[model samples]
Target: MSSVSYHISNLLEKMTSTDKDFRFMATNDLMLELQKDSIKLDEDSERKVVTMLLKLLEDKNGEVQNLAVKWQNNRHTRHYQWREKKPKYNKGG
Candidate 1:
C-alpha cells in the first residue's frame, strides 16, 4: 500500500478504538486529509471511508458523530458530493 493508504488505514483503525478520544482524533485527522488537495482514495478506500462515516454518524461520542456528519456533508467526499447542493422543496397550491 502507498503512504496515503497506510495513513488512511491507521486513521480508520483509530476511529474504531474503544477509547472515544482516539475515534474523535482519527475522525478529525481524516477530515483534515479530506481537506487536502492531494488526498486520493482508491475504490476500496472510498467504500470503506463511506461505510465508516455512516457508522460514525451513530457513534456514542457526540464529537465523533459531529465530525462524521461534517465529513459526510463536505464537498470533497465523492460519495456525498451531492449533499452540497441545496435541497428543493415542491410547492403545491
Candidate 2:
C-alpha cells in the first residue's frame, strides 16, 4: 500500500483503541479526512471504516458515542446526496 493509504489505515485502527482519548483523536482525524473532497477510499476500506464508526456508536464513553453519531449522520448525508439523481430542466417551457 502507498504511504498515505497506510497512514489512513493506521488512523482507522486507532479509532477503535481502548483509550478513549486516542479514539476521539483518531475519529476526529478520520472525519476531517472524509470531509476532504480530494481523498477517496476503496470500497473495502470504506465498508470497514463505516462499520468501525457504527460500532463506535456503542462506545462506553458518551463523548465517543456523540462523535460517532455525528460522523454517521454526515456520512449518510453525503451518501444520499451522491446517490440522488438531479432532474433535468427543459428550456421549452
Candidate 3:
C-alpha cells in the first residue's frame, strides 16, 4: 500500500480509540488529509473511512462530533461509495 493509505489506515484505527482525544485528533488529521487533492483511498479504505465518520457523528463527546461534521460536505466527492452506506444510528432512519 502507498504511504498515504498507510497513514490514513493508522488514523482510522486511532479514530476508533476509546479515548475521545484520540478520536478527535484522528478526525482532525483525517480532515487535513481529505482536503489534499492528492490523497486517495481504495474501495475498502473508503468504506471504512465513511463508516467511521458516520459512526463518529454520534460520538458522546460533542467535540468529536463537530469534527466529523466538518467532513460531511466534502465526503460525497471524496468517497463516491458513500451513497451505499447510510447512518443507521439515526432515529427513524
Candidate 4:
C-alpha cells in the first residue's frame, strides 16, 4: 500500500503523460493489493487509495474508465457493507 502511495506521488508530480492506461493500471494494481488480507492499513491510507481510484475512473479513455468503474463498484459494495455494520458496546456501558 505504501508502494502504491509512492507511485501515486510520482504520478502526481509529473507534468506530462497523463496517460489513462497507465493510471488505470496503477489503480488496478492497488485494488488488487488491497484485496489481500496480509496488507494491513489505516483508514487514511484506505481513503487515499479510494480517491486515486476515483480519479482513474474519470480518465478520458473509455476503456480505462469502464474497467475502473467495474473495480469501483466492487469496492463500493465492500466498503458499504463495512460501514453498515453496527458498532458494538460493552454490556455495562
| List of clashing residue pairs for candidate 3 | none
lDDT of each: 0.86, 0.86, 0.87, 0.63
lDDT of 2: 0.86
Root-mean-square deviation of candidate 3? 9.3
Q: How many backbone clashes does candidate 3 have?
A: 0
Candidate 1: stretches off by over 4 Å = 75-93
Which window of ten consecutive residues has the lowest lDDT sum in model 1?
77-86
Task: Give a tens-digit lDDT track for model 1, residues 1-93.
Answer: 999999999999998999999999999998899788678788899888889989999999999999988887784655455455548677872
Best-to-worst ranking by TM-score: 2, 1, 3, 4
What is the model-wide C-alpha lDDT for candidate 1? 0.86
Clash count, one per candidate: 0, 0, 0, 0
Give residue 91's error in model 1 in angstroms: 39
In order of appearance, the predictions have TM-scores of 0.79, 0.83, 0.78, 0.63
Q: lDDT tens string, model 2, 12-82?
A: 88987899999989988888888887776888888888888999999998888998999988987898875
TM-score attained by model 4: 0.63
Please give the range of 10 consecutive residues that has the lowest summed lDDT in model 4.
Answer: 8-17
TM-score: model 2 vs. ground truth: 0.83
lDDT of 4 by residue, 1-93 (tens): 477566545543331237755665655565676676566556676666667667766777787677668878888787776677758789997
RMSD of candidates 1 onward, in order: 8.0, 5.3, 9.3, 4.0
Poorest stretch of ten by lDDT in candidate 3:
79-88
